[model samples]
Target chain A: MRNAANLRVQVESMLESRIPSALTPKIKPPLESMSCGISDIDRFKAFGRGTLVEICGAPSTGRTTLLHGLLAQCTAGGEAAAVIDTSDTFDPVSASQSGVVLREVLWVRCGVPRNQGRALSRLDQALGAIDLLLQNGGLGLIALDLANVPIRDARQIPLSAWFKFRRAVEDTRTLLVVLAQQPNAGSSSATMLDVSQSSVEIEESDKPSVEKHIDGDCLIRTLRNRAEVLRGQMTKPVRSVRTIGEFSTSLYSYR
Target chain B: MLYAGVHLPNFPAQAALRNDAEARQKPFAVVAGTPPQVRVVALNSHAKKMGLWVGMTKADAETQSSVKIRERLVRLESLAHAALQDCLAGFSPWCEDVAPDLFVLDISGLSNLMGTPVQIAKSIREQARTFSLYIKIGVAHNIDSAIHAARLTKNVLVLPTGGEAEILRDAPLEILEATPEILGILHRWGIRRFGQLAALPELALSERLGQEGLRLQRLTRGISTRILSPTVPSMAFEEEMEFDHSVEDLKSLAFVFHRLLGQLVLRLATRALAAGEIHLTLHLDLAADGVTAKEPFFTRTLKLPVPSVDVTLLLKLLQLDLEAHPPGAPVMKVVLHIEPMRPRVVQNGMFVPQGPEPQRLELTLAKLRRIVGEDRVGSPELMDRHLPVPFRMANFTPSNSPSRKLPAEVSQTAVRIFRPALPTSVEKVRGTPRRVRFSGKSYQVSHASGPWRRSGEWWTRGHWGRDEWDLVLVSGDNKRIVVRAYRDLVTGHWSVEAEYD
Candidate 1:
């Protein structure tokens, strides 16, 4: 009887080991991963809409020129754009020369105060106008031409204000572009396009000294935390500068 | 009653004064100084009849006219035009600056307030006379006729019905403002005067000049059918209320903000728009204090997701933000401006219902955004392919992102997960499995996988290069664990990086 009981126990242990007990299927949780892309523009393009692209630079650094180029591209793509001219610096003749369709661009002039006494009030009014355009949205490129805005005053824009603006831009496909003399306020996520005039030469005829003409070369640096790793400082020489009518046109070695 | 056109004859006395402020008596003519390559910008009317025409070079003008010449300054002309515009503001509120020193005024329904149009014109001319500028006035049924009559006849030109063609018949083609190319084409067709062009068949004109020619033909016929639509004034998203009592406290001011936000939201929703940014203005009630009313203080705009008309949400967000950064002083009246409301397109899903529910998501996100801020909320958006550490990442508002298509031919390699992996030190061995020590606990390796290596972005500022290994080990508890190990390319030290659950 003892030999028979031991045999039964041995048989049960072998069967349990060989047959394998029933196991529950592991419920796989949904994977949370971000969609990846190559470049900032590519990442934005994947979102499938025109975004706010800000081109900011110091004085006489081809800020307007770059803006005109972008505007032309947008128009060619059958997209509309608006310019909030806080400094009354938008020249239509130059815009047309840069290939922007004048009819397609909505130019809002934020008139400055003629009186020196009301300068602060005028500045506030201009900012209000800029705020209006940004909130309206639906623009392929809404450029705030703060290139002519005083850097000291523009710096007065609080950092929190920039964060709010960045938050406003978040998911919407609109590319928010701010054109300023310097990087004043924007989220760390903002793509900063910095432009600087490399060399400038002023030429005037000996007889007609009243006519002051200028020739200059500009260097544009597109810096972002998320751009391709380029070796050294990417530099391009701009050549051939001439003023046609009211606009100054230049040709660069690289596009 | 006001005429739309004006002309100024070149006064020889004024020309003499311009040539030499010292020489008081010599007769002179104001002539355009055109460079050799460029056309003459402008010329005095007196210089025109002296056989010196516009577009003539300075040398040519000197040879053609016997009268002593003084160059007309384009800058001075523009300045004078601006002065005239300012002066005309007394006559009409609406004025348009036309090119080459012309001003178009809409004197409609202002006859009683500013007297008759004729009286207004006389007042404007008188103002110009005070500035020592010569002037002419033309009154007509419409602007085109008035301008034409002022140019064609040196008097106010009135046109009734189809009198436009008759008046323009004898006028020169230059008055039509047609481009030189169109003029050359018209000259080829033997059409010189405005009357000749106006007399052509519309179909023929359309064929010759295309649409532009057709427009000119219509303009010349005194059709004057186009209405002068005034420019629409800029629209603002401002809501303001006068306080029954000029209370000046922070708490009361916050209440005013609540009420203003409520009104602003209603207006925004009615227009199907969402406010992306908002500005707060606090007006001080200093009228009783015998001081000039100061301008309202402007707050740096606060941006929001989706257009929200909710007073409570706005109040909560504003209160928190404002408390963190409050206004400088007490305010009497508060104004809220929710500007730049984007047109809200409510997309009703085909299979799902649409209502206030989805908006609730935006409100919830906004509340969370207000607390933790905009940066910490959303998924990391990959902006560039530079350093992995400093790669661009942005927080996006939660919304239906368009689905991303995964690229084909992806590697089927299993990805390692990092959970509670403790750093482990292992003694050197061959390229295969070996016993490892982790957290003062020893484990025996049963299975192993992986030699997956990744290199960092060395072309940029920061770079990393490491070789990773995945090893499965059995513990004394009879439980199995997978540990990932990597050797620092620089230091040549191996460390446990992660573990599989």
Candidate 2:
């Protein structure tokens, strides 16, 4: 070890002009990461501030569940979060069951009566609300829920508006997550994910079935979505192997 | 006790133009009477120079194109007077409301906090200027002397002990507000100035003017003494403005609201307070045909989730409110009243993660409320009920989110609820649902669980009974999905309630 140290010092002295501190390793500050309350998804990379993420899935595909989990993670840690629900379909009961601090979340429900025409107005209002919230720049998380919004209605939103949202939240502490049925943010989103029920091979006991596991009865049990996440884009440099992320965890503790 | 008296000169005229900086620069007269009987009750210095005097008919005043005429607003005069007392009360606690235009404060102990007598008097004059009152301040060793000295001075007069009598000698005796009979007797006695009244023999004056004579003598001499009748400071924060022309556009009202809210904020801030709630009353001008509502005032109340002193934010809130529920008619006058509260004092922890700033968040929330309906934007609070999806929206405040100790890592499950549970057609055999159709798709229930019975509120009109089940449905393409389905026993209807991912 002494001889190696001497050799290293001699090599550093020889390479001093070409490379300063050749023997020392440069330290980089660790990226500030936020958890979406899912271990499989969080392991890939540290998702830091100043990024837009999109969670797209079909109905009953754990999209709302994952959004609530992100909200729960954000609010339980004393950070304020907001949800711009374009369809006014947020369930506070399920969110509370998921450990989301309701008081910490600002819910802007842009739902209009069905009798009231102009489905396009709801989308516009939601987008305008997101812009306002972004311009003020303080919330830790802002989730725009377009899950119930029809594809035709959601597509009416101009691409430039999405880019504006991306630009507004850039380099800020806000983690803007857009929840839609399909990819609407396109290239503006930093992290893109597609979720569906996992096709995990069932055991012999429940052959050819998705094998339902019922904890205690709804008599006194909670409902949670255990969706399999297929990551589309990530913030880190590496691609996820198989992309089997725990996008939404199941909280079957109590009803 | 050393007393300081503040007297507002031409108060009615000043009050009529207090809110209008432009009108204050011109000749203005406030006339009060019945119709053609209307006469000039008060006139500004400019109006006085233009030959406008008290009791001059409105027609006579209108003859002078240079003089602006306004109907006397007793309300404004009272507001100005209260504002003056509020200003003086800030300098000293013991303030006596001697008259509408006159007030005296016992400034004996204020030197420690406000400095010397001269400084207090100058500060009083400056503070009163914000309320748009032209004031004359008098600081003397006695209350009556201070009152008389205040009446005699153009601005501030600090009279030493025994010096008020000499300074007030040249002042008009009309400041006493004597009766006409006494005025006639004083006129007959050739006593036009206080010096003549003070020089009269006390015994002889009592013989001619009765007991009122001796009292007048001491007051004229500026040697009078009396207890300061201090009034209880009323906690009221109100500001109002009347426009020359009825304002029809909301944007135009914004200009008026901005100015009024600024004054209210300044007054609240001076008292170390903030407005917890604001009530705006816009007096509307009805159509000449009387088609509009008889109640001409359109009222709106804005309750802040967090009391704030940010004038811009308050103005934005008012603007948003006015835009949302506009007074259909033109607004002729605006009255703003606020419920004062101590501004929130929060010492954020250095390690705590940042939340949206309280004030900016409010502004953003207000803007969001404008886009969304008023009742639609807020925090969702779950209500305790037997019904499915029970919750109400609550105003969001930064402090509402509390810090909690979290485990090293937490992963929780969530369910997506169908706001209006999707209606479904059930294919049942022997009281068992074998298939379901919803959203234009038919699904085969390959695996199903027992019905979980939920029933409550049996005594109320909204009583409900439902049997819920977890169904694992397989689509045509072999795509599997899990959903919670329910059947309302009361209606015997089946619906897909929520989905577990």
Candidate 3:
């Protein structure tokens, strides 16, 4: 009978050992994926619907011309565009002559107060108008023209403020462009397009008298510096300037 | 009471079946979408016998064994949970799915009835093998130790009373659930392994790593103070409708978008939640070009605002934007996403009359933009520059606020014209005339003004050099036209740059 009980005990033990535990538990974590890389802008030609680009330069530079070309390209491609005129400098006739579709372009004029007693007050009002527009979102390109706004004042803008602006633009499809007269010292996130005038040359003359009629050409230089390529070829000090018109001078010189 | 915990790597049951059918006839491997990919999803002993390794790519495995492949029907996780519950039902009334391949079995009362902790673990392993599933067992004083030992050490780890710290000290940092950023920080600090972290002073760790450091310290010591809270029911509400046929054009896509928006709005209205953002996804048929047996290309996720549930408004916006800016090609399918619904509440004023909220203005503008097109609306902003005539303008989006203060010096030096003088018609004379006719009027050049010459930006391609003259012209009708004329230094032609409006 004892031997029989031993065999039963062995069978019971085998069965008891088969039971699973309830103390331990398993948990799975979520998986993360990799992001794709950015290719050349030209590769995204048809995909430039909401792209924003900025052109910056010193006095007598070609900032406006570049903007005109971009607008003309968009219009030529049958795409509509809007221009916010803070300095009241957009010449619609000239834009039309440059192959821009007049019907496709919307021009908004933000007037600088003519009767502002002080220049500083006028600047403040102008900037305030721009500030108001930026607080509202949803534009393919929002270009803030600071060409007329002096470089000193542009630099006076705190770095922290630019950082805030960058953050606001983060992850949004909209492109925020800032045009400046000079390189406004700040972080590398802001794309800087620098325009500079090279030289003036007289190439032709219509009249041969003492008061000689002259034809002149102006040279313009464009430099595009972005954050990703800042460390490499950007250090090259070479500047490219293209001559616009050549002048044939009789006898004329500036003091 | 005897309890057993079974872990069948990832998709082990299906993997076993696939292997058994092939009978070492083909090389096979399982792929789990995990990093390093070394952690085996599953491997059949037969395939292993053919020198095939787990985590090998499908292509590589086929090249090796030329085996007939069978994909798993159910997720590895659900199948393992069901299997574990079935096998351990007698030992514990409760069983929990711990992870993709692990489980927790409550065997507290069964320890006395079972032979010994080691014997119980062995029996469990033996039973699991019958089903072709491999499991690691740990017999510890508590759940934390048991789980740690089961996951970290070997098949069977019996921890002594105070050996928890020693057992876990040599483990890798990956087991700590450390983020990439935190891991980088630890690596820079020369704390490569878990033992180094465990040996650090709590005060120093906290000061350097902040709250995360404190949590890491606790985890390293195997002192998981966190309780396993019961899973809460998901509150997310989503509805999906499958199309009878694959959609390939904008019209069909728009139809789907309309239907989806209606359903989403109805659901949101019932919940009293206002959806601010919506995401639309399209699935395209990919089998059209005979590229594969599957359907052709499909598009997904076209995000838009969710201010109103109006299907017409949504459709109009979508159609307009698409016509103005169409996707690269025809899209096949679409899915709409309405995100983060908040309680719809509007605070009204009792005394003073309330005006429309700013958000309403946005909606109105959005509608106008849809009709007129986005590029047709906005205020003109000056292109920041130190140049004249060639000033660029930007679209006035309300969000481009000036975050920084303008310097006082710059405002003083720059001359800002209120309006760009429209260059009206100019009378061309044989020579540089003292006075010129403009706008059907003549004016005497009072101060035959300046030759303010400006040259072109040649580096940017286009160039222009013009000698400008600010002529104070007075007409016979007594009308004054302060005209600025420039003789193009390049073309030898004269043109009026600006005229006083």
DockQ by candidate, in order? 0.01, 0.37, 0.03
lDDT of 2 by residue, A1-255 (tens): 999999999999999999987996755344456776667767644345577777787765677766776787888888888999887777788788777888889998886632123343777888888989998887888999998789988887888888998898877878899989888886777667777655422212333333424421122122333433344234334354344554434433423
Residue-level lDDT for B164 in candidate 3: 62
**lDDT per residue, candidate 1, A1-255, as tens digits?**
999777766766777766542232334332221111222223322112232334455434445554665555554444455666665446553355445555445554455342223343434544554454446554555566676567888788777766765666545434455677677664332345544433322222344423422111112111112122111111112122211111122221111
True contacts kept of each: 0.00, 0.59, 0.06
Per lDDT, what order, best first?
A: 2, 1, 3
- Displacement of the residue A74 alpha carbon in candidate 2, Å: 1.9
B1-501, model 3: which lDDT tens digit per residue?
A: 222334444455343342143333444455445444333345565667776676676555566554544444344334334444444443554455566566556666766787777777777677565434567876555455556567665577666556667787887776566789988999898887767888999998888889898787676676654333222212243333344355446665665566556545554554455556655454545544432323333323333332555556656555655554445444544545566356445554453222223353344444434433354344343443334554443432232222132211100011123253333344434334466654455567543444667875755656667777755455665433334566778776665555321
lDDT of 1 by residue, B1-501 (tens): 334666554433342242122332333445543355443434554555656655566566566544455555554454345445445555555665554445566766766776765675666677665544556666566776666666666544545456668867878777776899998888887888888888899997787679889878877887565445332222355655445356545666666676566545554554455666788776665555544435445365777656666667678667756654545444565667677567556675563311123334344334333333343223233233543222222332323221132222111111122222346666544454477887677878654444556776888666788766655566787545445677678877667654321
Choose the strongest candidate by lDDT: 2
CAPRI quality level assigned to candidate 1 from its DockQ score = incorrect
**How do the candidates score on chain B by TM-score?**
0.40, 0.90, 0.39
**Per-residue lDDT of B440 in model 3:** 52
Model 2 C-alpha lDDT per residue in residues B1-501, reported as the tens digit of each score: 799989988888878777777887899999999987999999887888887798889998999998888999889988787777777777777888989999999989888988988898998899878766779999999888898788888898998887777888888888876898899889887889989999999998888789989988888777776898789866798889988788787898787787778777777766778999999998888963433546788999998878998888899889877777767788889999999999888887877888787778888887787778779888888888776677888888756345565523344445667767899999875456789999899999765564778888888998988988777778898877767899999999999987765
CA shift at B48, candidate 3, in angstroms? 45
RMSD of each: 30.1, 6.2, 29.3
